[model samples]
Target: MADGAGRRVDPDVDLRVPRDRREVAAHPAAVLGAIAAGGVLGALARAGLQAAFPHGPATFAWATFGVNVSGCLLIGVLMAVLRAAGGGPPLARPFLGVGVLGGFTTFSTYAVDVHAALVAGAPATALAYLAATVVGALFAVWAGDTLTGRLLSRGAR
Candidate 1:
């Protein structure tokens, strides 16, 4: 198997369920801890934002939408920077990209919001949100990655 950057990975590492201690060892304690801690912080940020911009079932989920789109953009930026910096600090990806940003993004919550809209008899709203989230997220990722890459290249000149 290969990772996002096309680096070869152990085929077994691709398994959804680790079969033994060897497979489990792929997730080291430090990385897991970082993810957990970052998750807490990210989740708290999401909560605070949501509380600030409260929305109901049929309303636009501005906070969640912003969180997810911003998270994707950051993911793209992080990946580009990491690539440019030759992977950067070892735990940077895990802590920031995977942990913090991963925690910040909430696909499950997005799904729930969509579901709630549909159940609230707001099919149009739900459809709009569904499309908007996907489109916005894609555009954000592209913009962040492309813009950051260009900036980095210019800086190097």
Candidate 2:
């Protein structure tokens, strides 16, 4: 990266652009509405944290991370719960997890959060948070799947 003296920054530096940023981000209004519902919930949750957190420039943003992680965890567990209960069904899985949380916990938001941290020059924290969120979320999903599988199997038995 360039210094205060205006040295050239490396163009090869990694940036977090969504895998299919343009296509995914640019949807028609109705499609956006489905996604937006979850985003509203996530954004509101983030906003409501100001009173409780009341610290850090990005404490509000931590809410988004939490929502993303929690939603992933919940989806894994809930899917199993539904399968075990066999209560017919409700919302489609894609509508809730992919459409909702996917829209809610935006790669764009995470990328911007990271970018903000990076530009503010807290590269260490940004990288650490990035790695933790990505890796931790993956592990959490696996764990959730395992836990749910056990719970469903228990019901089967």
Candidate 3:
């Protein structure tokens, strides 16, 4: 098959799925198990933190905010580390990034916090939190990735 760019595409290859056999094989039980295990650990950690630092309506959901931002940072670190290590194991990204960080970051809770704040007649607080979380998360990811990359390069030197 020829793509729009006139590049020859393999007729047997499914564009939606991974082109690599190893990746395809890795998608079944082992990968799932890794994600499940990582998710369980991440969820537990998030839950523990939330429990320890409970918040109420009209107040900052500091625990959830911290968890999400930290998780994003860790995701960046994990990606940098993986890239430095030539992508590491196949399961690494899925387990650590997708599973662990995905589980750890609570978007639902963040939404609820915003809703609760607004319902409590704290629109300013809600808006502030909403903006802060987004900015904080982006900054965290960028900082983590960049810092880890620099550190790794220094070590290599």
In terms of TM-score, the best-performing candidate is 1
Which has the better lDDT: candidate 1, or candidate 2? 1
Mind giving the per-residue lDDT tens digits that candidate 1 earns over 1-157?
1223424132112233222123236658876787778888888999999999999999889999999999989887887787677656656766787678888899999999999999999999999999999999999988988999899989999
Per-residue alpha-carbon lDDT of candidate 3 for residues 107-153, written as tens digits (9 for 90 to 100): 99999899999999999989989999999999998899899999998
Query: Which 10-residue span in candidate 3 carries the lowest summed lDDT?
Result: 3-12
Pairs clashing in candidate 3?
Answer: none
**What lDDT tens digits, residue by residue, belong to model 2 across residues 36-78?**
6765665566556534544353333566567567766765665
Show where candidate 3 strays beyond 4 Å.
1-24
Top-down TM-score ranking: 1, 3, 2
TM-score of each: 0.84, 0.60, 0.83
| Global lDDT of each candidate | 0.78, 0.54, 0.78
Which consecutive 10 residues in model 1 have the weakest lDDT in total? 8-17
